[model samples]
Target: MTTQQTFARRVFLVAGIYGIAALLPQYFMEAQVGRDFPPPISHPEYFYGFIGVALAWQLAFLLIAGDVRRYRLFMLPAVVEKLTWGLATLALYAQGRLAVFVVGFGLIDLTLAAFFLYAFHSTRAERG
Candidate 1:
C-alpha cells in the first residue's frame, strides 16, 4: 500500500530470490569441479565461497526488511553495493558479452536498488 511497505517487500523478495538462486551454482560447481565436466570445472571452491557471501547478504536484508528503521544504518551500504553490481551487469550486457539471464536479472535488481534508494532518502527526509 504505502511506499515504505512496498519498498520493504521488494527488498525481501529480491533478497530471498537471490539467496535461493545462489545455491544452484553450488550444485553445478560440485558436479563439474573434478570430473570431465567442462572448462569451468576447476574452481568449485571459489564458487562455493561466493555462494556463502550471497547467502549472508540476502539473509541480512531479509532480517532487516521487517524493521527497516532498526537497521537503517545498513541501508546506504546495501543500496550502494547493489547499485554497483547492477551497473556492472548492465554494462556487461550492453557490450553483448554477458549471460542473458544474468543481465536481465541484473536489470531487475538495478530497478529495485534505485527504488530502494529513493524510498530510503524520502523516509530519512521525512524523519528529519
Candidate 2:
C-alpha cells in the first residue's frame, strides 16, 4: 500500500484501540462498584470529554491521510490543533490535575504530534 494509506491505517488502529480503552474504566467501575473497583475520586466528565476529542482527532486524521491530495489543506489545521492540545496537556500536567485519563489524552496528543511531523516531512519531500 501507499505510505499515506499505511499511515492512515496505523492512525485508525491506534485511535480505535484508545477509544475502546477509554471506556474500560467506566465499565469496570460499573461491574465492580464499591467491591473490587472503586469509583474514581474525581468525576469522569473531563475524561469522557478528552476521549471524545481523541476519537474525533484520530478519525479526522484517518480520513485526511486517506485523501491527502484532496485534503492537503487539512494538514495545517490538524497540526495546529495537535500542538495546541499538546501544550494544553503539558499545562494540565504541570498543574497536577492530570490523572490517568488526562495522561492518556496527552499520550494521544503526543502521538498525533509525531505522526504529523512525519507526514509533514513526507509531504515536503514529495513536493521537492
Q: Which one wins on lDDT?
A: 1
Residue 92 Cα positional deviation in candidate 2, in Å, after optimal superposition: 1.5
Write model 2 residue lDDT over 1-128, tens digit each, in one string: 56864664466456445555654565435334434435543656665676567667666766775666555556667777677877787888889765556666767766776776666556554441
lDDT of 1 at 16: 58
**Model 1 per-residue lDDT at 68:** 67
Give the TM-score comparing model 1 with the true structure, all chains together. 0.70
| 22 Cα displacement, candidate 1 (Å) | 5.4
- Per-candidate total of colliding backbone pairs: 0, 0
How far out, in Å, is residue 48 in model 2? 7.1
- Give the lowest summed-lDDT range of ten residues in model 1: 32-41
In model 2, the Cα lDDT at residue 61 comes to: 67
TM-score of each: 0.70, 0.56
Best TM-score among the predictions, by candidate number? 1
Deviation in angstroms for 24 in model 2?
A: 11
